[model samples]
Target: MAPDDQPAPPLRRRGARMRSAVLAATVDVLAEHGLAGTTVGAVARAAGVHETSVYRGWRTRENLILEALAEQLDAAVPLPDTGRVRDDLVTYFGALARLLATPQGEALLRLSAERDDTLPDHRLAYWSDRLDRGAVMVARAVERGELPPDTDPGLVIEALAGPLFTRALISGAPLDATLAPRLVDLVLGGASAPKPGA
Candidate 1:
């Protein structure tokens, strides 16, 4: 599927500016109050626009928030087809490590992890969408006989990304691009299923 955060085809100048302002407010609100408190009214206030503008434009608070998340995720980590799973993973993870160390990335991670049943499902769906898109890499590796057929792509992603998140959010360890290859090595060494007839 095409990336949901693809740039708008085009829009009138006023409309485009409004949308950009709203998205900027969305991130600000998420950083300040998180998911539960971020609403169309709040974002509109922060953006200095009418609530109707935000509501009419985004339809729901969830969409506005997710637009911000999707934009940042797309900018921070791009999935490239390098014809080799390990190389692709290294590139992806290295970029992620760098992003996670940034202020916006850290705020996004904290807000994304918030658990609020009253909120729209977009917060969690953001991750589901990410995994869905990322699975293509693992699937490609499987086709190349790098990973076993039964190996779970989502789990593999977790194995690779989870540690980076931990180091960034929990452990407060310094992040380095070099960690990407080491992470790929660890994930691959333990990722694939048992060899045939071992």
Candidate 2:
């Protein structure tokens, strides 16, 4: 048994490494090429893995792109906990605005808007999960009394995000640095304002 005859490492280790590489490469490719241009061959080449390996693991290009985009979005927009709801909202939405202004982020927004019968449910699920995760900030604010108990976290998040999406995906408006604070103030203003009866 010569040292050269030693078998390769186990499939688990190789698979894990390949998965990481593929996901990272997929994000880069998506950023560079957008959804229409991204392909398994491009991602595999970027990842230094065989196209068959990517297909075997992800089963489809849509799945691979969705997973990569989801991972990137989660990392890029984290919920801020500054102990003050206003500051938290400003920081969180500010990061989101910045991300949405980038080429990669714009590509993701366009990808989400595309009507793909194969990914309709999956895309909706992804956005629903993101809204839920973002709503935690408002939920915490309510628990801390920064916002009224009646505040709808999901609605608050949607209100803050809707305009940004429109600007990025529809009107092609600029996502400036000042926009997040302004939006946070507008949404939180109504949320924190005293009720008519109160």
Candidate 3:
């Protein structure tokens, strides 16, 4: 049996490792240099891989960077499950605030400001999932008799989240520890359903 005739081992392990490394490098570059700076060459150099490999695998630099950013957000953000709705919201949003305060978070915010059309449609779905999670919190509270039975969960979430985002992005205000609860309180202040006959 000639050596060339032997079966070749699978490249699965190496491929997975390289994929992880390349994605991490993309995130690091975006954090340090912003989206415009994370060229394929830059990421390949940072990841210690050949540029051709990245291009062959990811097809485009924009796709790779967006996937990398989405991976980070998916890993970091989770639905809150605490028994109390307000506490759950505060905790959930507090983590988001801290993340948004980082360089990577700031870079993502810049992406939002620039209105990059290259961003995939799935990213919007991710945000919608997050909003649904907030709705779940409101639904749970309603089930527990904490709020009115007919309360609009989406409205409840928007009221709770809008100010937090405003402070983090538009207003340039610090997301102080107390801000989460304050926002929750404001949202909960009118967390009731309209009268059935009204």
Candidate 4:
């Protein structure tokens, strides 16, 4: 049999590469076109894959977009364990602010805010998962006594992140270098664990 006649690589091996390419393409499309303009055919063309493949893998454009956004967030904003709650939060929110300042990040922020009645539950689930992931920073702070035991991790995260989003998506304010530390200070001031016997 000729080499040309050889069958293509097994689906499992090719699946990984295809998945990565498709996700990357999805992000690029989202950044360039926004959520309303992104389509499976566009992503498939960008990724050099068939439209059916994307449909088969992600089931819908919403799912594809969500997975792509999740991947970007996980990579761009990491959970820090610097042993000091202030430092960890500063570092994490710093990364988040930086990401939000970028065009791609701005697109993601807009996408997250979009309201789709048909996918309200799915959107809530997506936000819930992301908030839960970010809450780890607060959880660690509480464990280390850097924050009060009763501190609400999700609320703390929201408090720190809310202004950043507002600045990026609403106020047209700059996400400057000092912003993260300043926000962290503001939130942590009220949330910090009190000094012993004081």
Candidate 5:
């Protein structure tokens, strides 16, 4: 076939690139205008796509925001397996506390706070998944004899995060760097420790 007569290869849309664009735009809109300010049209503009394109991919603004924020949350907290329960809990919560202490992390919390009835159930599911990942990691440690088998993973996870969120959202106190790991140790170690009277 003559070079000029060769048919052009069918153009393929890059799924990864498209997803990256969407995630990037989500973060941009979040950082720029927060949750209330974020809209399909604004995110589309930021991502260099039409509003309909975003809607086609995510179906709604709430869905798009949830996916984007979920991506960041996933990156923020990885499943911990450091071979020691105390070490693992410390590593996990410490990282989370650090993230919450940052400007982007604070903004992310604010975005979550702005959620209304229009928000989809998937957003709640997304957070639930993140919580489950942490729970599973701790559960494994309990199963391994590193932590007491009776130790409640859900309670442990809550203890690790509850105070941080409460202070940030309610009391307005700063997240003290020294307190996070110590709190993790108290819960995990306390549960596994033998009773003094026993």
Candidate 6:
């Protein structure tokens, strides 16, 4: 039998729908009440599921929140893979900036940060996991001679995103499409430009 002749697999589509419902409801609860408001019972009510169902899938509110956050992140920003490091980074963080400006995104960050005093390790782990890939890409650019080998990728990421975040949250400025690419250009120039002696 040819591959095309094989029967279609079972949809199991309900799993996806249920997961999405939980995540969407979680986002709403987080936005309205912050992290403290997203209890298992609250999420269950919001998702139209029995409290038992939530416990069956996730034993605790923290676990549920983490899973929901991961799902939300998957939708908010796609890490760019363009050959140009600067362009790719700018585009990536630009998307992130836009997300941060949204109601859900802002609420998520604030809620996460609000818990930092109690769970500093969680904050470090979360950022380290999320940022590892981006750091690798910048490091690769340096290895390829596209950037200074000694440059700190962490610092590079901060430079690219710091201004945008500041502008959005602190200065009340826009992360307009035009401004994002321009910021990329400025950072890329600083990273790759020949030094005075070299």
Candidate 4 off by > 4 Å:
1-13, 190-198
Residue clash pairs of candidate 2: none
Scored against the true structure, residue 90 in model 1 reaches a CA lDDT of: 90
Candidate 2 lDDT, 1-198, residue by residue in tens: 899996554343366777888999998898898777789999988887778888999999999999998988889998888999889889988999999999888888788888978778889999999989889999999999988899999999999999999999999889999998888877876657864335
| Higher-scoring candidate on TM-score, 1 or 2 | 2
Q: How many clashes (backbone atoms < 3 Å, residues ≥3 apart in a chain or on different chains) does model 4 have? A: 0
What digit string (tens of lDDT, one per residue) describes model 6 on residues 41-69?
88878877777767777777777787787
Query: In candidate 4, what residue range of length 10 has the lowest lDDT sum?
Result: 6-15
lDDT of 4 by residue, 101-122 (tens): 9999999888888886645677
TM-score of model 5 vs. true structure: 0.82
lDDT of 1 by residue, 58-176 (tens): 88776787898888778779997898888888988888888888777888887777676644487777787887777788888888888888978888888888888898778988788
**Candidate models: Cα lDDT each:** 0.80, 0.87, 0.75, 0.86, 0.76, 0.74
Judging by TM-score, tell me the better candidate of 1 and 5: 5
Candidate 5: C-alpha RMSD after superposition: 6.1
Candidate 2 CA-lDDT value = 0.87
Better of 1 and 4 by TM-score: 4
TM-score of every candidate relative to the true structure: 0.76, 0.86, 0.77, 0.86, 0.82, 0.79
Candidate achieving the largest lDDT: 2
On TM-score, the stronger of 3 and 4 is 4
Clashes of each: 0, 0, 0, 0, 0, 0
lDDT tens digits, residue span 20-66, model 3: 88889998998898867889999988887788889888998877976
